[model samples]
Target: MRLQPRFRRPGGPWQASDAVLAIPLGLIVAILIADILTPPNLPLGPLLIVAPTMTAWFAGPLLTGAVGAIAVAAQVGAGVALGILDMAFLAQVLALVAVAVLVTGLCYLRTRHIQELAQVRTVSEVAQRAVLRPLPHRIGPLQVASAYLAAEENALIGGDLYAAVRTPSGTRLIIGDVMGKGLTAIGDAALLLGAFREAAHRRAELPELMAHLEQSVCVNLAQPAEGGEAGEGFITAAVLDVPDKSPKVQMVTCGHPPPLILHARQVAALPAARPAPPLGLCEMFSPEYFVDTFALQAGDLLLLYTDGVIEARNSHGAFYPLTERVARWPQISPPELVDRLCVDLLEHVGGRLTDDAAVIAIQRTQDAA
Candidate 1:
């Protein structure tokens, strides 16, 4: 029987932890019951702390805050009614309320801010979907995975791009970086992707398809900025073609950073034979863009990323250790590894990134049984 391969969807909504909420709810009920049984002399500090913390887990930050406030109020009322309301008890209650109020307020603000963040993410995602969108996990004989990080504080749009499509010859891939960041960068990325997608499918030669993309950029820059491609900024990119399912990958670069090859716990940049100036900067001269070949082995992983990831600066303004970090990741499924890397990378930056960054990991899977 022939087996149909299942593909994984990339870049979707973050699933809230049901356990994080459930545990808190259970703890709240248990603590309240214990409070009822033990009455006045109960040590409820742990319960109180857990109450506010639980609020954040279950009902989200807003609901968590409200729950925390209610818990604090209940504790105060119970203490007073049970005759445990001495001066010392009053100080403790005051302290509990103060802490609870502060925590809940912060959670509330975070929740509200997250809502606004969701809106921006939705816009950025839609902007990308209409332009670049997601790629199929498998194309003919190839298996693929991709990750994108928009370096705009909490915004989700970036100038980095990658695309793969199977054609008459074989599977062709385009990994490129548009100059600058923000909406304008997105415009340049979109233009390059649109032209490459159309031209790659129709044009017989790789050079012609690349030429078409450069032409598209020129035209996009010529028009009254649609979707924010202004000032005729250029983009650096690379295109790959693996014709006839050969073990060699033919590639052309446009002043972009070189991609890294990961094999058997070792990661190294693919050596370039010759490179060319970035797209949109071709008006002054006709640059000689050379096409080089690299050997591709099954089970090997190729990492194509824009400058945002490697160049991400920490508090000390130090660049992220990409080679060390990726090497540290366990060789596992694409999404799991990428998720871990994302956490590790963000933690290094103390939370979020400052520039647009994208990472595309393409792994060659052995032919399945």
Candidate 2:
């Protein structure tokens, strides 16, 4: 399903309270202006000092200072012209104007900083879209949900990857682990996914589809050295083919973890009936390497994940316990289960991780209209 930026209230160390200051600032400005027109018995020029502060409280310091400077200059010029205000008062008004301008200048600087932050966020959001496209809601009637996290503190993309699509033959799905991290791994991941989509539709059988992927990578690996190509890079992927209304799903393991099966709210590991060696290797498969089959049921869910989820090591170096963690979450809809699993995994790692992660969950939905 499609994802959105998780919304949370803006949080930070500094927050100026405008509520308590708004009314008082407004009333003070009102009183100062009244004194200007209706001269009071007592000189109220000193009270005009707070006029600029009202702008800071409501519109932020930058606009506040501008208003303050204008009010102070007008009051000073008028008072001196009328001969009612003394030299001391004129000096006081100039000082107040200078202070207001200084405060507003600081506000202007902060506003520029905030704009820079917004620009950075926009760039991040675009990169995320280019990296992880929005997931489809239903792939051949299997309700799907996914969660992806980049390794770095503020990263929005990563090396771990997954994709699912429905074809005439069956529903094609893949989950893979790129060897390393950073932009290089992400590029390889993109190539892998691009090949998988086109090849999954072209190949006649599971092994053939796997071969198509290997060949795509091999072609790149064999490119001229000047092309910035690496000869031995490879990814471990698990490819699945599930037909419409079928009770069993055919799959091949290319050095990927076994998919978890969820039925009636219980989770179990689906045995790889006959696992195949990972793609991109010559003579890597033995006679035993063949397509595995999983007997599925209505409402059954299959989960494919990258090593990031399982290999997440804590400060103590103990790997994350994924199987055990899911065992505790009572069965729910595919989306809900996906959500809870993500939460549980994040909690396991203390809300942060050093490696990228990806999770793909598919549950058979009631027949579509």
Candidate 3:
């Protein structure tokens, strides 16, 4: 959803945040009172420019212009009350007016720039959603929930990506992280997600689906980049196939972190016995990919995440303990589990992450068993 800036509405009434305008207004009043009480030689009239200058910080152009006008009028009143209409007094008034006008114009430019940035952010979000479509809350016998955090400020998606598709007999899921971050890595991420969604339904086996993804990434990396040089990029990923009739999940890892299974208040990582190289470098390793099977009983929750989650560090440089943290809330539903983890992950990193993170939680319902 598009989010409007909270500073001001297009045509609606003023918001409570605007109450901060009183600071500048109060400064103007205080200056006027002090000017009246002090001697003429003190020349306090020059300080009135501060009112409009301060207003520019919290208000838009129109409100800033109003404050400027008030300051100018007060300067003139102060000059008359002091009985000093000398050229110096007049110059001080003109100088105050000039500063106020300059600040007001600057405020207008800043506001316009913010609006343009908001437009760009909205378009970026729409494109990200199209490339990394949200997973369904319920897919056959499995309940699913996913969350993503971008290291780049104001970005909705980055190197991390996840997607799921339902097949004739099961649900296929893929969670991957590109080798880089920000806009530079979005192309590879989009390519991999597109390939996975297409192959997830057609390919009958997990290894075949992964092979297709590897080929796609290889083709993408082979292309010439912006400077007409061959691109060099890779993606770490884990692909899983969970059949509706079986109590096990088939997984193939491509140099990615292992997923965790939470059951009976215990958490265990499901690392592949022999993991394949990352997508673009698969040709460098053995041509065959190994598929690992793990039991995923009813009431069991599977947690898939990028390395950013486990690698997140605190002030003391200690890594986030993903397994221990998840084991504490093993009984929660898929959505609740994901929501709580996202919050906790951000808090652990001091509310800002240094790397892109993506997480997915899938739970098998009792009836499906």
Candidate 4:
């Protein structure tokens, strides 16, 4: 169903209420002056329609109706002042009233539709918070920042997800993408985030944490497909562990995108040496996930993201070059870096994305304790 476009109230050096009062007053003054300046044969009564038609855009139904009524009253007074209250002049008055009534009805319907849309958007934002609470700006010694963009417009949550929290061993984080769309994908994302949050504190090693996540997925999703084969539901994930005292970060990839490391005006992809299967299908085809250790010195930045960022296409069907664009800024704060990336990504895809995207940035500060 195609919905009506939302009517935006007046702003930017103009107030809605002020315009409502000022427009009809200006119209009445102009009508009076035109009646006096022109000859009696010239009909200036029809110009009264301008007041209500313009006011309908910025006022509520009742206010619009009042403006329409004022316009009709002004036309009748003009006729009396000109000493011609005959059938032709009376007919003009009736026509002005009819047009005002129609415009008022249209304004009423437009206002009602806008209210309903606002309520729906509020509910969606609340659901997004229930699924994925906002990540903090700081986790332990690292400055953290995150951003998410859903595939559907007016939607707040989707298949892409990320979580970062201070754990017993260190600060552990995971960014994953579930294998579907809409509510089904959101459910899977919520389940994965819940499992990761619980297991991250107990398991210190990256492989062990991924193992726990795999077990959770296997137990939670076992329904058979239409052909009686096991259901194919899986999540591509990347898990990372950052210890407090060491300048090293350990990462494990499960068929997901490798993270990028930025240091000293250089950017490089940290691809997994031996990649394993995604979470849900690992039970059927067991593959050993390996922990790839890389040095993460102070002032270095680590960026974890979903495939949506790299898969966004332009008008020419060209995928976004994330690595090339991100290398330009190696010394900004984590929050500023994420903000810049979000703006640039939107520009690359012409201000819209076909898939859900997410990004998490963590910077190892220079004064780590």
Best by TM-score: 3
Query: How do these models rank on TM-score, best leading?
Result: 3, 4, 2, 1
TM-score comparison, 2 vs 4, better candidate: 4
lDDT of 4 by residue, 1-369 (tens): 126454545232445555456867698779868976799899888898888888887777777798899888888888888788999998898899889999999998887778887888788889888888889988878889999988786787799989986876568888999998888788888988999988888885777888889988887677564577665689999988898878878888999999999988899999999988888995578768798899888889998999999999999999999999988887888899899998999888888899999999998885445
Model 3: residue 23 alpha-carbon error in angstroms: 3.9
- Candidate no. 3 TM-score: 0.90
On lDDT, the candidate that comes out on top is 3
In the range 1-369, model 1's lDDT, one tens digit per residue, is 124332111122335543454565566667766776784556663466677865553345555666676677777766766667678777777787777778777766666666676678688778667787687777666667777776665455678888887788688888888878777787778778878887888877767777888778877777776676556688888888865456778888888788887778787887567787888875776877678888767777777777878888899999998888877764655555566667787888887787777777777676322
Lowest-sum lDDT 10-residue window in model 2: 5-14
**Per-residue error (Å), model 2, residue 355:** 1.6
Q: What tens-digit string does per-residue lDDT give for candidate 2 at 1-369?
A: 224432112222334543544553565566556656765355565565566655554455544665676667656655765566666766767777777777677666665566677689799879766766767877777788988877765666677778876688568888888777777677778888888877877787888888778777667656654467555666788888888767778888877888888777778997576666655554354323478887667678788888888988877888988888777766567688789877877777877877888888888775422
Model 2 Cα shift for residue 130 (angstroms): 3.5
Task: Estimate every model's Cα lDDT from 0 to 1.
Answer: 0.72, 0.71, 0.88, 0.85
Query: Tens digits of per-residue lDDT for model 3 on 169-279?
Result: 989999999998767699889999999988898898888888888888888888888899878878999999999999878999998999999988889989999998889
Better of 1 and 4 by lDDT: 4
**Is candidate 3 or 4 superior in TM-score?**
3
State in Å the error of residue 308, model 4.
1.7
TM-score of each: 0.65, 0.72, 0.90, 0.85
Question: Could you arrange the candidates by lDDT from highest to lowest?
Answer: 3, 4, 1, 2
